[model samples]
Target: MDVRLARKYTVKLSFEEIRLPPFEDILILGKKCPQGRIGVFRSFDFLVPNEFESYEVEDKSVEAVFINKRVLKKINNEKIIEILQERVFPYVSESEIIKVDFKMTIFYDFIEGEL
Candidate 1:
């Protein structure tokens, strides 16, 4: 009888700065996401107090949307909801949590004595 043993191991390591709240401007939680809206909200509230706002969506795929309050300042709530439903909801699933890097650009025109 002969016995032979061989073992090989490969390891990879990477490191990056930890991002607070682990997300950017938006966090979209599906209906069946692992973490409920309240838990997620609490975590965000603790990390960045009064910075994020959560809202429930009426769509079947999306459970809720957590948007930065600063974003709300730039865009209205109704418009935000409308954009999510029209663009993002169709790609989301009931059991998924999605992180969105939202960006807003504003334009303004001013003329002297045009009030």
Candidate 2:
């Protein structure tokens, strides 16, 4: 007696408009993320050169954080990290890459003349 087995495979397809850099303002990379810091940094450099700044963290969950340099000009780097620690880091995992659309609003006062 002989026995035969048959296998079938199903494929699903989806389309998305690719966005360069992917993240809008910030990208939080977990410690064990599939793509390491150097690779991500290099890609960003090629895609949007000098546009982002990388910060390697010494935390348990998060490995590094990438912020738009423009954002850095408006906000302190340490303060941004502090905000992430409190609001975002708690929900991230070692194997995840989280994209954050960090938005900021600033209010300023102007003086007509200087004394």
Candidate 3:
């Protein structure tokens, strides 16, 4: 029997306003910092696509955020965004965060074996 799973995630975060460098150039995030930052010796490994847009929402608390809605389909790897809340959310500072919300939709397809 084969099982297939499809998952979609929409993660929205609101934080203190900060100006980020434009995507025209590669951003070496956390490579060098004075202190209290993720200043690891190794270069950071995250790719920001040029297609992102900065939005102006009605809420005023948000400064900068990434509103990503993605769909992932796999045979066994069903939990994509669920794991991120553990690995990623820890890096966010409480003082900088205004709101964090997730919208998830899942679909399951079951196949029966033939006699």
The lDDT per prediction is 0.87, 0.92, 0.32
Ranking by TM-score: 1, 2, 3
Q: Candidate 1: worst 10 consecutive residues by lDDT?
A: 1-10
Q: Model 2 clash pairs? A: none
Model 2, 6-46: lDDT tens per residue?
65679999998987987779999999999989989999989
The candidate with the higher TM-score, 1 or 3, is 1
Tens digit per residue, CA lDDT, model 1, 16-102: 998798887888999999888898988887899898888998888888999988889899888988988888889999999988888
* Candidate 1 collision pairs: none
Worst 10 residues of 3 by lDDT: 24-33
lDDT of 3 by residue, 1-115 (tens): 4344565679998887553322221111221223212221111223334322222222222223333223222211124323434544445443343223334556869867899
In candidate 1 the C-alpha lDDT for residue 76 amounts to: 88
Candidate no. 3 TM-score: 0.24
TM values, all candidates: 0.83, 0.79, 0.24
